[model samples]
Target: MTNGPRVVLAPDKFKGSLSAPEVAAALAAGIRRADPTADVRCVPVADGGDGMVDAFVAAGWKRVEVAAPGPTGEPSTAVYAVHGATAVVELAAAVGVAKLPGGRLDPLGSNTYGLGVVVAHALDNGAEEIVLGLGGSASTDGGSGLLRALGLRLLDADDRELDGADSDVATLLGRVSSVDRAGLHPAIARTGFTLACDVDNPLLGPAGAVAVFAPQKGADPDQMTELEAALTNWAAVLGTGYAEIGGAGAAGGTGFGVLAVLGAQVRSGIEVLMELLEFPSLVADATLVVTGEGSLDHQSMRGKAPVGVAAVAKAAGVPVVAAVGRTLLSPGEIRAAGFVGCYALSDLEPDPALSIAHAAELLEQVGERIAARRW
Candidate 1:
């Protein structure tokens, strides 16, 4: 083994192109090609959304596959990572956009019941501390589905039980005459929960979940209105205090359900994952740190993985650079985000389609450039 310059490759997934592991592998290959003697370490990171479990697994955590329902109540096998009593459950794994059946969107019909099932399973299996990463959700049920799964019963005025899935949010919550919590999982009281969220939108109003994110989930104007109204009623039932919490609107108000009912603490997804992965120590001995995501733009500077990683690297006095699939930020803007330099796959492949299709190849080239220029 040669005592060469140590290069740490830590990056999030290049969405729709490559997973974080693949990106790190391609970059590592390019770095090795540039200088075979260079010491390279691959540490894939995520912002507590997609690829979260993979990040934990990469760090020697155990992957536990549990059967949960998809957004539309379809059977799905989702995965969570467990290391000792600490478990990490990603909401996207159970009912994310990709998990929708046949690429069909059911904005009002979908719910987070599947995610609740996964969390319940984790707690039942002796998980003491569970980290719930919230994002990429497919529904706007305000997390009623999850709460129901955890043994909360929604009883209608007629004393009929309400189903969390396949029901419109407005109709669902509007019909709820009372909430029953006597059957809640016993382990819930004993477990500690941390919610990994990025956005700070409250659970209602213009800046809230339905108004800002329902459209992307295939909700039309009328559906949005209905969802908003439903969530309003949900807030009333769950107590208006939870509705106004920061990040309470995340994952279609799933954050509210967890925070209000389960009493979970909220935190930045990237920051939480960085702590779990021991990121500071990972870059402590590194000469150059590489970090990025699929895009480096206005959002990237605001609590994204690359920015989060850059902050850590900068704190350790290690120069940080980015290797993204594409970048919308100017060089000055990139530097302002705490990165010393930035590289993009789009730099080599101008076409968006070509860039995504060959992101690994382009990332390798970017990797080579990083080694030649920075290493």
Candidate 2:
């Protein structure tokens, strides 16, 4: 009745393919294959972003679906999760880049208004505490649109009422001069918000969201400049210097806006997620911990889910290993990341397409090898 070594399988999604649970299952299956009696525990994780809901759901949070606006003033829906008084909202589900119309990615036109809609619904459903996952956001409209969704009265320089919901980032924030909080959401006033952000970029500057993330979201140079100026104006109009603070640039300025208007506190997505998943308790007696993402790169060290998982494992004195689909970091970097070793799918397949196409089988193989490693 004695099982093999106790190994914890915790990994993020492979992106464009396997999900965190799927990846964890594949890894677990491999561990089982290597040692048929091995005790495997799967606790998939995410740093906010797309896989946030999956993590929460796996942790037993109840998911609720709601109709909401998209980033670009279109019909869209967002999924909200509840576990007692705590509710989770994912920006990606509301207005993520994937939600954009076919072949249409408009960085300047999108906003976080959809996120506000989800928040409002959560408040209405008796959530006293809210967690907003600020990943996969498709808007750079500052928090103007989000605040608007929460009932803030946006006005132009002429003191006329302006619609932040249907307005573009530049057009709306460009015309705004002042704000009226008299009509702000009552629930927003009573609720406390915790922001789940993966990045530490500020609201404005070279490393800021606009400068670094805009391009990834499909904004050209001219559009970036224009959006930045509008964000600058939006920040000034709101009068919160938190724009320059770290994490302000997350989700296209949703972080900055939420922090400023809602008085929300920002924390690393993995940090928050660990507490939610009770990671330390689960890993306390484990012989080893396994984690990974789609690609292990230089960015992984900065607070990605795997790094966060390793931090927890290191604290518990458990050795950490990673099984990634691909890796762009060197051996030195990998060792520096606190991984005793890494198993990359590409190393086995040597073909990117084959690795992705056969990720499950490859991941299973990596898992078996990790279990087989004596150390």
Candidate 3:
């Protein structure tokens, strides 16, 4: 133990490769193989998406069930985690893109009505503060649906309730009522709302949510442009200009909705996760830290999980190494972003699918080799 380097196996999930806990477990296996008594700490993290429940659960949060709307306007029940008085709400739980069937991938028709249901449930359950994870959304309603579910009214030019369809925006003339602050749990009105998002794209622009993300949500070129225009108009009606808010475009405009309508304060999803996990203090005593995600590329430089981890390690003057599934950025680019080195799991196994299937084993092997080299 004295001869081996003290390491922390902190990594986000490799997406299709491994879960965060599994990644930590595999890294622990490799560390132990290299030095039987090596000190290793595993703190799995997520940027408020699929792995959020696992991360919060591991950190001692209590899970609660609530009824919410589904992606297709059906009734659904979702789960939120409570840590002390704070509630954790993940948009993915109610209306993630994964919840939609391949045949029903209609961005225009889907809405964030389910998200409002979850928030209302949290408030009713005595949660004062909300930590909303606005990642992996399936809706494109510009939050109008969510506001409607929360008791706010969206009226057409003729003063009728508007549907969540894309065509409804053209008919929407204004918001007719204020948010229902009544019966708002005493804890909620005074509590801070922290929104977690990974993207930096603003509400509306070339790099905004619709332009950059609508294609992935199954929008054609025309639909993308139309959605952008619609959301821009929606923002105008709400009197909140989202044209320049960073991360405003996240989660198919859900970010803009929560920020504008709910009065939420935004923070980088990865940065919030790091703070929640107390990553800075953990890195201070470690000699080396290993972190990665499914892919590491030029985009990683702009606040992705791996880069967030590297930033913490870099600040503590610890050497950070990344073992990723693929490398889109060169070694120099990674180094400049604060990672000392990067190794690809794909290089060790040429087949992409095989590498993902054997991710835990590959990561463990990589960790063991790195530890051995240090020794």
Candidate 4:
């Protein structure tokens, strides 16, 4: 291998800009331009969110495309990654907020039906294990819609069907009297399910699905109340204890449904991804590690890909830095989170719009800056 400082570039996608691979590629070019002898390795990563599937695909997984419903039941083409008997499914690839029509939030009508369709497809095609990446949701249906897609029937007091798409969750689920799972996909029992997430919020309560996440989906106070009631009713109908489990609130309670209904295991998103990518070994002899995302904010600290990568680098006794689009975090906060240096495109280009548009170029510049400083 070429010799100098062994630099590892591990970053998540710069949302609305470049993909993780693109970011790493740009950085690699710049680092080489600055120091041709430096041994630079690009290990793009994601934390079980929007770019999780891409990460796996970058690591040699096969990409599979399928027609699935969007957040509002619209026709959309989504993709998953498959390798061997395991399939990697990303919720954002199905009913993510980005799929919202006109980019308008649909707090009441959005659901996870599309996500369920993808999972079912994987199971039908003989996938023995599923790793679901949960984040960027656009619903507050407590995953009832997903269950419905998987052949679970929601009935009213009179045994009439209650369609989750018919109305707001409160209006729809409030009338749900029971569920019929006789038609649940046959493979559910045999296939193992794992949830890749960083959320620890429970399914119901002040810190739960509706109270904490609904607002982000554009739920007003009234809608939050309604969704809370809806999820509570759903939990009652299922009669399961998963509503109280950590991460049950993720992806609008998708975690709860998979846990209680499908018997899924939950794990840290980054942890799962890194293990799958065999990331630790890449850092074993690295001289410096650089990781980042689009924005370095409060949310990044909550087990986002960058933070997770930093943790791994630190554990390997490697110096870690971040190259991001923008940062709302202070230097002290960045250091506390294990990053020795934090570079932001915003520092190079003040205009947010311009920064995003030229992220690839700026990231290369950032890479050169890092090399000049570190080497």
CA lDDT, every prediction?
A: 0.89, 0.87, 0.75, 0.90
Off by over 4 Å in 1: none
lDDT of 2 by residue, 333-372 (tens): 9988889888999999988888889999999888878878
Candidate closer to the true structure by TM-score (higher is better), 2 or 3? 2
Which of 1 and 4 is the better model by lDDT? Answer: 4
lDDT of 1 by residue, 1-375 (tens): 677779998899999989999999999999999988799999999987889988889888999999999998899989999999999999999999999999899997788999989989998899999999998999888788888889998988777889744456668877787788899999999999999977888999999998899999999998888888878888887789989999899999999988889999999999999998888999998999999999899987778889999999999999999998788998889888898888888779889999999988998888889889745
How much does candidate 3 score in TM-score? 0.89
> How close to the true structure is residue 107 of candidate 1, measured as C-alpha lDDT?
90
Model 4 ranges off by over 4 Å: none
Candidate 1 vs. truth: CA RMSD?
1.2
Pairs in clash, predicted candidate 2: none
The reply for model 3, stretches above 4 Å from the true place, is 1-5, 102-104, 163-188
lDDT of 1: 0.89
Give the Å shift of residue 247 in candidate 2. 0.8
Candidate 4 lDDT by residue in tens digits, 131-163: 999999999877787888899888999998887
